[model samples]
Target: MPGTTTLWRPTGPAELDLVAASGWREWPPRLPEQPIFYPVLNVDYAIKIARDWNVPHSGAGFVTEFDVDTDFVSRYPVQQAGGRDILELWVPAEELPEFNRHIVGTIRVTHTFPETA
Candidate 1:
């Protein structure tokens, strides 16, 4: 992991299932309406999205962490969506396969949020 940067992703159950289906090695292709595959730079931002957004909208949420080659990820500049900690990298959909190649290790589900009554 020396040459890699750790990244966190906020995932809904459907997407988490897909990642699991890949044996935790790859991210599924973006859907037609989805243009970019974004991974956040911080776990806190990832957790916020998973807890506040994905849970309400998707009924379940997850936070995943993985490492990507620093050189490959550096091609996309870090984007700050709102606040200082809201940082992410936006990889175009078409480049995702190549981006997947730069992933250094298996993805892990660090946290999971299930629907609550």
Candidate 2:
């Protein structure tokens, strides 16, 4: 079956950077070669993983856009005593099932804080 497009909350700063750096200003980009890491509670660990796997030519890990309106807040709640904000990102249709299979899926995720109170 064809995969459905959906949005998921990224787990850390590294995932966030990957999204930003993807240059996907509009509707996220399709990451073919990239491998996402999921359930990544630690932003630092995510960053380190990105740094370690970031090849000069392959581009960052795979990222894409969701067809439906995502409920990021409901999916990933804020952690660390309100020091951070929780958000979700796009997961490719092709790899959705496999991504779910893994315990801590290797999907890219990022965190962003609100500017205003």
Candidate 3:
């Protein structure tokens, strides 16, 4: 079966800034307060997966993967909208099964960018 994918819409510029600064070193505080909502997977995971897949980095300090369809965003509408589409990150095949089993339909991953230096 094809893997599932999720669409993530960042809450705001602040959230985007947080992700850019941290590079997924840790989850940002702006993330929604709900266990069912799983914040975006660390960007480092994306970097590692891209390298493992032999994908080239654009030298932008960040990379995104897509078409694997292993992620799913919550259908719950945002209370207040307006944010940037930073990039679509993909989950690897090996990890997809685990994500499916544990996180696929149970949580919504929120994105929050921390303050920059």
- In the order shown, the candidates' Cα RMSDs to the true structure are 1.0, 12.0, 13.0
Task: For each candidate, give its TM-score against the true structure.
Answer: 0.97, 0.26, 0.25
Determine which window of 10 residues in candidate 2 has minimal summed lDDT: 64-73
Q: Report the lDDT tens digits of candidate 1 across residue range 1-117.
A: 359999999999999999999999999999999999999999999999999999999999999999999988999999999999999999999999999999998999999988889
Candidate topping lDDT: 1
Local error of candidate 3 at 42, Å? 21
Each prediction's Cα lDDT score?
0.95, 0.36, 0.35
Query: Across residues 1-117, which tens digit of lDDT does each residue of candidate 2 receive?
Result: 333334443223454465456353322223567543233334554344344444222345322222222232134332443235322333444544444442121333343332221
Tens-digit lDDT track of model 3 for 45-113: 434433333223221222322222343432323232123422333334344334434333322223222
The order by descending TM-score is 1, 2, 3
Q: Provide backbone clash counts, one per model.
A: 0, 17, 15
Candidate 3: misplaced stretches above 4 Å?
1-4, 24-27, 31-117
